[model samples]
Target chain A: MMTLSSLPAVSQAQAPGLPGRAGLGLKHEHFIEVLETSPDIGFFEVHAENYMVAGGPFHHYLGLIREQYPLSLHGVGLSIGGEGRLDRAHLARLSTLIERYQPHSFSEHLAWSSHGPVFLNDLLPLAYDSATLQRVCEHIDQVQSTLKRPMLLENPSTYLQFQRSTLDETDFISEIIRRTGCGLLLDVNNVYVSCINHQRDPQSYLDALPLHAVSEIHLAGFAEDTDSLGDRLLIDDHGAPIDNAVWQLYEKVLAQVGPVPTLIERDNQLPAFSVLLAEAQQAERYLAQVSP
Target chain B: MSLQDDFAAALLAPEQACPDGLFSINGADPASRFAVYRNNVHSSLINALAAAYPVTLQLVGEAFFRAMASLYVQAHPPTSPVMSEYGGALAEFIQGFEPAQSVPYLADIARLERLRVRAYHAADCQALDQQAVLLALQGQADLGTLRLQLQPSLATLNSPYAVVAVWAVHQTEGGLATLNPWHPQGALVLRQGLEVKVFAIDPGSVAFINSLAHGNALGTAVEHALEASTEFDLHQCLTLLISHNTLTHLHLEQKVSP
Candidate 1:
């Protein structure tokens, strides 16, 4: 297995970006509350696809809340890991959104969501072979050049792996960062979920990656089920509170990397704004402890 | 086929076998693991449809809606990544769907709900203010040649069933029993500021608004409405449009002043 240490070290220095604190995924249900209260948060993140519409309440509220909070545009449909070329039209829409908001940070996933013209809407896994690695790097390079900004690539939670894979997941991510010069979003919930499902050590998975390249972090909840063998299966459903085990792994990450910008994402079965804010505050407390 | 080709095919087609080379670290069945992706894709897409068509979901129960939406997802997966833009073909799909025939008006309700979704996200444009509308009406000579530009969010639906009444009843409590779903009705959907409002209008008014939306001049649109119904009231329709801030621009066509 090729280790990250064997590869030539790229500069880990990052340009000034999102503050080293915690943020929450801005939900439409909480737009009015956010505007009225103007909560003290590190920033607010939103799904780029949700705001792709030309104009509407989504844009209207986002424009208002953006004035007060630093915004991160997280994209879910870029298909950065697909075998085919990137979707030009979707890329154009993303460009338009970036131009409009000028968000502090932009991120997409390592998983593929679309095949050809049909979008599956779920973040599907990839075989970490040389061919898949090259395709993913090319796609990331295209996105960076088109948007004229370095994007953060997120790690995905997978239920299955392919026998054809030639590289470890961490090694593939390390090479992609080395090749394309993009930063890592470092979704901690995904780390916990994938590690548990695959029977790997979460700490070892984190240590193998180029931690210096991490620019942001995501913490979310997962739904638990069992596989055909009745072993534990973790689904990255983002429908509940962050698991205690994931939080422990996150603290370990902060201890190593010293507080990257973190986001609390709750996409399904959303609770009140106060509940999400409280979770963000909990992350902030951990971040405060690790602050230099 | 390529890896993604095989994977995507199986994701949408539940009957197909899981793609080759997939394995779980715990030695679990690949097919069961793959079922997670299948369930996510189908349920999420179905949920998007259900979100866009709440009334349609209510008219039919959840189980029926999910089953119908699952078939719709397999038949017509989203072309665009924007989930908001997904399920535009659903109204047309429901029309030919064999099971949906029991609720014959289900397709029209779907159509209205889709229009509301579109209106909610349409481009924002400043509507012609009341003063501008008044000034344009004052120019009697230009009235015949006046062309009214509707808001991008404005849409019309003419249904053989009382789609507007049925939809309106769903907004409140206990009114569904009072609605006569068999009566033909027309609807006008427009965004008043941020809120998308749907109003029940007469069929002739639908014809008039549709004509105006097609860029027909005032005189021509009135004639179209009159042809649709002898009792078509131009004043009432004009009031509805102006009050709802539907007209964005009033243009007077320039011809040789003969």
Candidate 2:
């Protein structure tokens, strides 16, 4: 079991989270529990937006606790793959947060959340056409230039397919990386979830991805239910413990992708810190066995 | 419309249904696939709002927050991908909002919560010391015509309700539902080190801070403080602001000679 005391010493100037270990998304409910008990998770991940408030207890705890653990600012907003021009105010806010925490790795979804004045809070799907691809790449370029750091773009979990999408999802991601030199935050659960939703093979989806471009792997629990047609449906709920299928998927990906930073994401119904640490330890075990 | 834009519109406003080309199922209706994106958009947004205003959720309960968030999502959806900055205007909406009228303090809570969010994401700056500020103001004897600077992370809000106590209670371990209407309170929100904190300010501190926030200099702020209460201690307010890192940059508004 990797312990906090034994983990790499995190410097104020260093990127958050020690390399080649598994982490858990730190929810507000588990703040003191994780801090007081000091769980042996590899590191902790937080939504960049959660701590984006001014002087409050959230920052108070994060500031103190972040001193001991490597932290990553996983952003769900900043829709990097959106069609509209990047919101400067949002970028400025994100810049302030990045400077304050100096997280290990900054990441956002490869989907748009905004349309003009209305922001659809979900990671809405984007067409995988060449024109859309160029727009996303340009947006990523703008973000990287402004932040002066490469941001990892996570593959989104999709429910619907677009007719105008001229490019495959894998090819779109590959082209994005080739153009912008950005890293990939590949969520394995998302692959399985999307695969089941789209009636595709998860293995084929994962195999098609540019594994070398991946800087991180995300594993989380999904709620399994049956569609009206009795087909298996997987919803990436992140509210439960890691499911066996997702774990097995993680192991398979680990075997191929080798050791990358893996995060166990549990956003809702967050359990005790030990519960997440145990989950992280499970991923750590897989990371150790991977051919790093 | 571009495919992405069409998809975005369809997801946000399910009434603006997608054409059959977006997804073609062999045996299913189009709404089945559209429902997935629709559900995703609603649930994800509800979750985001819950995360943003946990206290508000706690105040109204999950079911109510979800219903309210769903309505909020329809009326005012997120304009930015950054979820933290998404619900800044929620408090304002809750003010004119009818369903939440019984909980009059809810809007103030949302306002305070938004302030807390803004302070956390505000720019980073080093606070100036009292000595420097005092020296800067040494030559200016005109007390009423002075202006001062507040920190980027500092936000001040006044409320007839005991919003500070209300926020404080929800923050504490056993204080979730303990609401006391007797004590009127105000809040001074700021980020200290890496954390955002909210301090309950008395009437004098509120007046002094508001004056400074209005670009009034130290002398004018002190004057405002004195008018509120003869016992208003400017030094105490100054010390508190300095200690909390509420003042980051110092500036003087040029005096307009009459």
Candidate 3:
């Protein structure tokens, strides 16, 4: 058999242009369709953990995709918000992937998904205390220095809150950006979900955000599961189309911060490629109206 | 305990109260708010396990698999964020699970599935240079010191039960043939290009492959294979491994100083 190693390395050396106004989370199911059509979009975002493999179909398809569209490496596993020290092995893998992909924007959540050896496989919430804040800042600093590039921290849609948190979620994110000099990935869906779950105002929450630091934005669908009191609890499941409320919130964010590299994320029950592209086109239309 | 620890534990178990210093806004119930996380954590992990071990889930039926997965998540949460790399211990957990004691081959099936997932993600490497191997085998090229390297994705599943047949039958929609649990079966998991495949082999091939996998010289591995089975065919096994591209690199013996 021919050597498989040489097939991908040659092309991975060249860098694609950075993403523009709108992109979508590239799923494996849509790889073939994407290659066939080559739809119009700013870029495609892939989970850094999925492509952590040595080499194979993942890289093969990614190589083909990277040749055409700009790429963004979005990480869900870093657990930057945790009190535990960052996993050096995981960080090493991330560094290698960044060097290989050279994605336009490298972003991870402002949430903890791991504690010790146990990986919960979810973007978990954290208490925004001074100690936690310091821990998060140190982790971000390490990640930025190790990656040799400024990273963007995505705000997560949390279900619970900690009374110990003296800082509001926005202030807490702002403080991290201030200390680490990292950019922000403002997810409109997360803002709407966190506010609805906490009975806080979404507009006011967006108003307090460090939008200037926001280099990217994410818009995804959320699930509406009821709480014990029969109240709606928004879960950021990313299984459906962007809701009308979230779209309006995206409009508000665009009105405030103008255009940013926004992504339409749909992880589960993925629709046809055309569906995602249309949503991305919608984002482009909204972004077009802005005076950036 | 710290708030993070309590919060982590509470997500797994609902009987445990919300973490210290947790409160709901607008007088909403904190437990109700916290339940969202409990739902997300358990369901997402359960879904991931279900996706990885669909055959196991299929064999035991969805209802039982869900319960087993729920219990497994509580007993052992993931230590790494690679969801595909998670659930390495599910097969072990299933062996002790009370409700799953009936299907004795269930754990092995889970193991077979796990190995396939690992092979799918394992590192890529080039296959053995067949021309050099042919030349070395044809000549009297110090067989005692000839070393072989298999692909990193290669694995062997040695089981007392007919696991390969049991797994194969489950792959299609058809009649459920009787699988003799006492029948010994050995299967070699191979990866070609991008996909992984499992092939049932005889006891001798398993013995020879096991020896080679542990870095034994071809001559030593052949001896072990002969000991395992009188009719061991070293040439045929070599041909099979080379054909399947399981053996990636070969190292012939060097000339020793007189």
Candidate 4:
């Protein structure tokens, strides 16, 4: 057997150009397809926790892809909204992964997914109050200190609204970014979905957003459903094609926000890679016009 | 003020549930709205568990797995936000679960599956060579007390059922033959490159590796192996371990005569 230690250290140096382009989430079924063809997309993103293990097919494919393209480590389990101290072991695992992969960007959700020892496994909303805002700011501070890098916190697609919310969603996000010096992962699809679900206007909400802090953009599909009391609701399913309305919103967002590093996310009901490539091509066309 | 804390409290206290009175014009009821969040949480977690314990889920069909997973979640909703690390205590839970008691091997299967998951996520390290290991072992005059360091991803599990056969069949994507539970089997779990691999180990190798893992030196571990089986082959066992990357580190200390 070849001596692995004798070989030169794997050049984990980041690829020069990754930012300001459209990317896609690399899934299992697409790994072989991606490896063979090497799609012309900007970059790829993976859930850090998904690859948090020692050896698995995930790492194998990721390692292969890492050599070719820039990657971002998007975390869904950090639970930045929790009240207690951050989970050190979880942070350590993430640190080790970062040390190995050296991703271009690392991010997590602004919403909480865990409370005490009970993790809901869903990005549940938090009431926009001073206490909760302060808690979230402190958690972001800890995460930045631990990782020694600024992380973009994505806004969640909320289903329910709280009556006692003293602060607006954009304001809360702005406050967190201002206090912690972290960046924002503006999910335009989420903005449209949450605005409809909460019965708010998307443009006004966008107007209030801290556009300068925005580092990345996420565009995904949304699902509309009715509640028990006969009300219309929009859910961020990310399971279908990007709705035409959302695409139009993305156009509006691009016109204002300039060309951010946008991602086309599809978690369920994955289609052919070409189908995704086609969507990305359309995004590229839109980005092409505005980038200059 | 903590939305997560308040929402979590409401989810737990389902009996006293009061709708938040928030409604959209398209007939999306508040109760229905709440249910969507609840379903997403439960289904995602259940699916995550199923992914981690494929063998356990296979033994008990999806229906049973979902039911058991529901109970497991309520009993121990994940402490960490990482769902991959959620089912750490599933083996113990299976041992005591009344409905699954008939299977008997289910708990062991859970143990093996959990080990596989752990081995996958374990920290990456270089395995030591045979020459280095031998030199380290030779330093110890008394082998009984010398504790050998097991690979961080290594795990040993024994089962009354044909766990290796069961796990093997389930891992394959094609049609699989049904497994019989009568024959006893022992398995050693470890990661090779980017995949966690499982292999069957003889009774002697199992005892010897277990002893070495508990910090016994080669001489004493060999004695334990011989006690388990007179025809024990320590050389072959050590070679197997070195080849498989199960023996990552070695430590030698003074042995105590019993």
Best by DockQ: 1
**Better candidate number, 3 or 4, judged by lDDT:** 3
Candidate 2, lDDT over the whole model: 0.77
Cα RMSD, model 3? 5.9
Ranking by DockQ: 1, 3, 4, 2
**Tens-digit per-residue lDDT, A259-290, candidate 4:** 66778898877899998888888888777767
TM-score of each: 0.97, 0.77, 0.92, 0.85
Candidate 2 TM-score, C-alpha based: 0.77
Rank by lDDT, highest first.
1, 3, 4, 2
> Candidate 4: deviation at residue B240, Å?
2.7
| Model 2 chain B: ten consecutive residues of lowest lDDT | B24-33
In order, candidate lDDTs are: 0.91, 0.77, 0.83, 0.78
A1-292: candidate 1 lDDT, tens digit per residue: 1222322324332344677888999989999999999999999999999999978799999999989988899999989988878999999999999999989889999999988889999999999999999989999889999998888999989999999999999999999999999989999999999999899999999999998888889999999999999999999999999999999999999888777789999999999999999999999999888775
Q: lDDT tens string, model 3, A196-268?
A: 9888899999888777766778999998887766778888989999999999989988787666678999998
TM-score, candidate 4, first chain: 0.92
> Which model is ahead, 3 or 4, in terms of TM-score?
3
Pairs that collide in candidate 3 are A117-B79, A118-B78, A118-B79, A119-B78, A119-B79, B128-B248
Off by over 4 Å in 3: A1-17, B129-132, B140-144, B178-182, B254-258
* Highest-lDDT candidate: 1
lDDT of 3 by residue, B1-258 (tens): 666777788887857877667776656677777777787789889999999999899999999999899999999888787777779999999989888989988998899999888888788888866776677667854777888888888888877778888888888897575656568787788778887898877777889898999988888888888887787887788888887777676777565899
True contacts kept of each: 0.91, 0.52, 0.74, 0.64
Better of 2 and 4 by lDDT: 4
Which 10 residues in a row give candidate 1 chain B its minimum summed lDDT?
B135-144
Deviation in Å, model 3, residue B86 alpha carbon: 1.1
